[model samples]
Target: MGLKLSGNKGQQSHRLVIFAAIIVLMTLLILYGSNNVNDAVYAPFHVATNYAIKATDLKKWSGKDGYVPFHGNKTMNLQCHNCALVTSSSHVLGTRAGKEIDSTECVIRMNDAPTLGYETDVGNKTSLRVIAHSSVFRVVRRPNEYLQRPDSNPVIIFWGPPNKIGKEAKGTLYRLIQRISMTYSNLSCFSITANKMRKFDSLFHRETGRDRQKSHSWLSTGWFTMVIAIEICDNIKVYGMVPPNHCGKSKPGSKKMPYHYYKPRGPEECVTYLQNEGGRRGNHHRFITEKQVFSRWAKQYNITFTHPNW
Candidate 1:
C-alpha cells in the first residue's frame, strides 16, 4: 500500500510539470501573436523608411551619372541660421504675412501646394520642397508650375513606401526625378528612406506617450518636414499649423476654416482624415497626437508656432 501510494504521488508530480510547460508554451505563443499584429500594422511605414535610407546612398545606384548633387553631394546642408516651416492651412489666408514667411533664409513647403496666387499669404520663396513619392508624377507633369520660381530651385526631398523607391526604381516617379535633376543644375533631389523615418517615429513616441502602432497611422508630411527642420536649423518657426479640432471648438459665428487655404472649393480630404483619426473609435493617423508631440518638442527645441496657436 505504501509503494502504491508513492508511485501515484510521483505520477501526479510529473503531470503537474507537464501542465506548467504547456502553460508557458501557450503564453509565449500569445506574446508572439501580439507582436506579429503590431508589426503588421507598422510594416508599411517601416518598409518605406528602410527603402528611403537605402536609396539615399547614391553609390547604391549603378547609374550614378544620372543624378547630380544638390548641396555638393551632401544630403542636407544647414547653412542657414533660421528656417520657416510653411504649411498650407486656411488660417494663413488673408493674413498677408508673405513678407514674414519669405524673410527666413530657408522656407519649406509641402507636396504640390502652391504659393503663386496666394503669395501674399504663403510666400513665393521656397528653399526646400518636401514631397511624397506618390506625388512625384504630378510634379513632373507641370514642373514649371509646381516648382514655382526658378530662382529658388528648391531641393526636393521625395519620401514614399519602400517598394516605390526600391525594386520599383524604373517607375516614372524615380526616372522623372533623376531626369529633372540631371537636366537642371540648380535642382537636386533626395530620398528620405524608411530607416531615417523609423528613427524619427521612435523619437516621437519616446518623447510623447503616443505609439504609432496604437494610433494605426504614420507621420504626416508636415510632421516629417518639421523633424527634418529641427535637425538642420538653429531656429525654426511654423506658420499655418493649428492644433486638432481648433475649428470645431471655436466660438460661435467664427468662420469655418478649410483644411488647406489653397483649396478654395471646399475642405480637403485631409480635414476629414484628421477628424476621423481624432475620434474616440478611430484608428488612423494621429494628427492631434502629432501636434501634441510637436508642442512638446517646441518647448525643448528652438521652435515657435504662429497663426492659430499650437
Candidate 2:
C-alpha cells in the first residue's frame, strides 16, 4: 500500500511467477511419466513372480483345510518345459496334426472339449483341462463316456465368479466339482483365486487398453489357460487358435474355413463373436484384440502358433 512498481517491472514479476509455476508443473509431470514407464517395464515380471510363488505354494495348499483337495496318490507334477496348448478349434483336426500335438511333453486342453471321437485330429492325450464355472455342470454331468475315462484324468483348473465358490451358495456346478474331486483322486480341482483373477483383469486392461470389467465380461478360458502355460513352460506351442480375420473367411484357393473344425456347421458363433468384437453391434469379448495381444506375446516369449496364422 505504500510503494508502487513501474508497469514494466510489475509485468516482469508476473511473468517470473508464471515461469516458476510452469517449471514446477513440468517437474511433477516428468516424475509421473517416469513412474509410469517403470510400471510398464516391470508389471509383467511382477505378475510372473507372483504366479511363480503361488505355483510353488500349490503343493502345500493341497492338504487338509486348503483350497485344493489333496490327491489320493502322489500329486502329478505338470511337466511344461516344452508344452503344447491345444485349443478347442476345428482347425486342429487338419493335416494329421494330432500326432505332433501328442508328442509335446505337456498338452493343455480347454473346457470340456473332447478328444475321443476326434483323436485322429485333436490327439488323445490331455495333461490338463482349463474349465470355467459355467461349463462345470456340463463337463461333470454329461453322459459322454469319455468324461468317465481313467486316462482322461487331467488336472482341472476352474475359474468363475466369486459367488459360485462361496460357502452358502447352492450352485450345482460348484457342488458337483467338489463332489467329483472328493470321489476321484486322479482328477484334482483347483480354483483360481479371486485376487489372481483381478490381477489378470488389471493386466489385460493395462496391456490392451480394454477393460472387461466395464463391459461386464470375463476373460475367456483360453486366455486364462495361456497365462498358466506361460508361468510354467519355457516353450509354448499353440494349436488351433487362429487370428480373428481367418475365422469364417475363405482362403486364396476359394475354400471357406469353418469357425471350428469339430463343428463344421455354418454360422459359427465364435466367428461371429470375433467379427463383431469392436463393430457397431459389438460383443462382450474383444477376441480380435486378444489375438493381437497374443501375437505380441508370441514375439516376446518362447511361444509359437500352428494351424492358421497366429
Candidate 3:
C-alpha cells in the first residue's frame, strides 16, 4: 500500500537533513580552513621579518664610502665579523697578545709597521693596512718588506690630501704608488679620495665641536682606521690603545714606554701625547683629544679597547 507523508512530517525530515549538512560543513572548516587562514596571515609576516633583518645589517656598512680600489671602479664593502685594530703604540710591547690578535678574522695595521721582527707582540697577519701619505715613502722604499707578503697579500689603503694622491695630480709619491700597484698585481691597493677625506673632517667636527681646519688638528691615522672599522666591522677590539685620561693617571717616577712598539728607545708615548695635547695646534695630532672622542665612540658602538681595556 503506497502512502503519502503528511506535510509536517516531510518538513521535519528536510530540516533534519539540513542540520546534518550544516554540521558537516562546520567540521570540515575547523579541520582545513583554519590552517589555510593561518598561512595567509603568516606569509607577509615572514617576509617582513627578513626585510627588517636585512635593513639592520645593511645599516652596519651603508652611507660610508666603501673601500675603493686604486685601479678599478669596483667598490668593496669590506665586512668582517671580528676585527683587531693593532695600533703603533708601545702599550702592546709586553701584552703578549699576538696570538689573540691574530686569531681574529681580520688584522688591521697602520703604515709600514713591520710584523716580522715584532711578531711576538704584534701578530704577523696583515689582512688590511691603512697608511698615511707621509709614510708612503717608507713603504715604497722597502717594497719587498712591506708590499709583498708570501703568506697572504693584504689590501693597502693610502689616505692623503688630493694633491698628493689624486689621479690627475703629479708628484713623486703618487707616481710611486701607481707604479707599485702595476708591479705587484696580487697586491690590492686602495686610495681615499678628496671627497672621502672631507667627509671624515665633517665627521670629526660633528663628534667634536671644533672645526678640524680651524682647530689645526690633523686627524690621526688611528682616527681614520677607527672610523672605517666602525663602518665595516661587526665587533672591533682595539689593541694597545689608551683612554683619554690615561695621561693624567700617570704617577711621578713611573716607568715609561716608547712612542712606538717598533722604536724601543724612542720618545716616550705619554710624554709625546702630553706635548701634542698642549703644543701649537698648527700641525699637531691632538692625540689625547682624539682618544676622548674615541672613548665616547667605543661606548656608542661595538668597539672595545684592550691592552688596558676600556
Candidate 4:
C-alpha cells in the first residue's frame, strides 16, 4: 500500500476542486451574460470604424452636387431593419422619361428624368432628377412565364444575371457586380422593375403596405447598393448601405452575388424574439445577425453607421 491523502484528506480534495471550478465559471458568466451578442463585427471592427467615420464630416452625402429625391412617401430609413443613413427627406426626385414608361409611368415621371437619359414626358420640364434607392422592387415569374425585366436601368440591383438574363451567375455574384459593371459603368448601376406597390404608392404619396407576413418583403426581386459619400444628405446618407449579410473573404465554396446569396441557419433554425430583456435600456442586446438587427436599428434611428471598411 503506498498510502495517499493525509493533510486533512489533502485539504478536502483541494476544496472540492475549488468548488467545481467556481461552478464552471458561474455557468459561463451566466451564459455569456445572458446569451452573448455585441457583434457590430464588421470584419473585426472595420479599422476602428473607418477611423471613427473619418472624423465625421462624411462628404455631405455626395451624388456629386445635387439629386436627393426618391421619396415613395415617408417610411424612411430607406428600407428599415436597422436603417443606416440618408435617413429621410424620403427620396422622391424625378426625371427619366424618354420612352419605356409603364409602372404607371415609372411612378408619375420620376421627377422629370434625365441625368443619363429617357423620358416621353414624365411631366417633362427639363429632366435630370435621379435617386431611387431600393429595398425590393417587385415583379417576377420568368422561366418564361413572361415577366422578366432589367430595363428602366437606374443601375438596377447592381446589374447581374447573364447580363440581365443572357446567362452566367452560376456562382460568385459574377466577380462581384458583373466584373465591375463590365469594367466600371459608374460603379454599381441601378434601375429595377415590377413596380406595383400601387405604382409605388402612387409615386410617393405613401400607403402601399400589404406585401405580407414579413421576412424580406416589399416585393423582393432583389437589389442593394449605396455609394453616397455623404454630406447633409439628410437622415444620415443611408450610411452608404452594405449590410445585406456580407460575405467578403469569399469562401464556403465561393462564387456568390446572385443577390449576395447566403445560407447558414442552423442551431435549431436560429431562433429569435426576446425583444425586451435585451435592448437593456437601449445599451442594446437583442440580435440575430441581419447585421445586428440593422445595427441596433441604426443606433435607434439617429441613423449613420457605415462600416464595411473598403
Best by lDDT: 3
Model 3 compared with the native: what TM-score?
A: 0.77
In model 3, the worst 10-residue window by lDDT is 45-54
Q: What tens digits encode model 1's per-residue C-alpha lDDT throughout 129-153?
A: 8887766777777767665356776
Candidate 3: tens digits of C-alpha lDDT, residues 189-254: 878877778877866666566567775678889888887777777788999998888878999898
Shift of residue 294 alpha carbon in model 1, Å: 0.9
Clashing residue pairs found in predicted model 3: none
Residue 213 of model 3 has an lDDT of 76
TM-score of each: 0.69, 0.69, 0.77, 0.23
* Alpha-carbon shift of residue 174 in model 1 (angstroms): 2.0
RMSD in Å for all candidates: 12.1, 11.8, 22.9, 17.7
How should the candidates be ordered by TM-score, best one leading? 3, 1, 2, 4
lDDT scores for all predictions? 0.67, 0.66, 0.77, 0.27
Q: Cα lDDT of model 2 overall? A: 0.66
Those runs of model 2 whose alpha carbons end farther than 4 Å from true positions after fitting are: 1-79, 143-147, 166-170, 244-254, 279-283
